[model samples]
Target: MNAELHTLTGAYALHALSDDEREEFERHLGDCEACTQEVRELTATAARLGLAVSVTPPPEMKAAALRRISTVRQEPPVAPAPARPVAARFRGRRMARFALAACMAVTAGSAGVAVWQHQSADDAQQQARAAQQQSEQLAGVLAAPDAKATTGQLAGGASGTLVVAHSKNQAVFVASSMPKPPSGKVYQLWFNDAGTMRSAGLMDPSQTTEAVLLSGPVDKASGMGITVEPSGGSPAPTSAPLALMNFATA
Candidate 1:
């Protein structure tokens, strides 16, 4: 059983093992805490590795894929925040946000091409790059220390909600429930520190959102608000927020 441990990894990390193999590994791990730790470490590492990649997974495999992610070797823990914060809490939270966003960024960015396939052929080749741009914008906004999460709308009807939170170092924005913007006019985002509003990024069509996460961090922002801008994005918002909220910090 000890010699067979290595054989169980690839399948175990992805949870692809047969019943007997899984049982054997479980029993082996019970007596050998080292094996349990090894498995956990390997899974975390795998998930982390996968996060940086953009492979659209099949639309139907969302749950299985997310579940498997938690078990992967290189991935970090993506569980909900705990009740207490530790010394490394900032670092841990940063890692968690990036890992989650990175993974979703790939999938959501490409719209089920990488996340579903991870890199398999048959996915969109052009890369729904437009969507990727939008996700990147969301990440940028979330990183603001004064960022807050809530529902929003543009003058035209672009709508969604993102959670904006942060610490002294940076502001982070996480969003979902955003409808993809209209064709010519995108649901653009903006950051208004005081009176001047700066372009954040384009919002994807809201219909595509799936409770996926979006994040970003920025400096020199005392307060923030999202607004609708032109398709290519404007240096400043052309219209007011369809849905707006104040930063908790602000």
Candidate 2:
């Protein structure tokens, strides 16, 4: 409920709490946001901790678990055996028990490995999906009929084909033949998404034609503009546009 208790909540969730302290924090967690965040962070930390220590619970559980396994295991029917065969049968049973224990250990180890692999896979998938969603969003804007509003020429510049695209979201400015930006000076791009104007990017002029991507949410793009700006980019155009391409979506 309060910061002190909230901090203890983290310890509680992670099993780092003393018995009484644990009870106190658990009782308080019903209403605390700070506690909730800490609990969430600690839960993640605990999951990692759990993998570090794989001690099985209690011996009583092992007995019950073994009994459950025996109930499920199919035992071969007993047969009247010669005296020599009786010893062999006992040995065979021992071997089977040892093999079962071996199998269980292997299974548990495999499951632990599988869980870590699954998490890593899920993380990679999440990143890939995010990238794909962004690219798709960009593609939809690029493929829109509105994009034909203006024609971008791919000229044989000193760098490569100077291909450029423009839209309301922003101008997709790129130049292949252009040379890289000077040591400190960078090429900047601009777009009039509506009446509002904004600088697009500060990039190496030489690599400009390589079609670098930009994230935008833009409007009423009347013209595409490029300028020389400092590294990274600027929010607004500080200098004259080096190149201008005018286009209309309507």
Find the candidate with the highest TM-score and give its number: 2
lDDT (Cα) of model 1: 0.45
Model 1 lDDT tens row, 53-99: 32444777988888999898995866756774322333333444344
Cα lDDT tens digits, model 2, 1-250, are 2334533433343355457655555555544433343343333233323322324367699789888986796879877666654234334434444344334334322111111222343444444345334344434444444443343443235321122234445334334345566677777766656645665555543333333334454445566666667777777776776666765444
TM-score of each: 0.37, 0.38
Candidate 2 off by > 4 Å: 1-131, 152-171, 193-196, 202-208, 212-214
- Please report the TM-score between candidate 2 and the true structure: 0.38
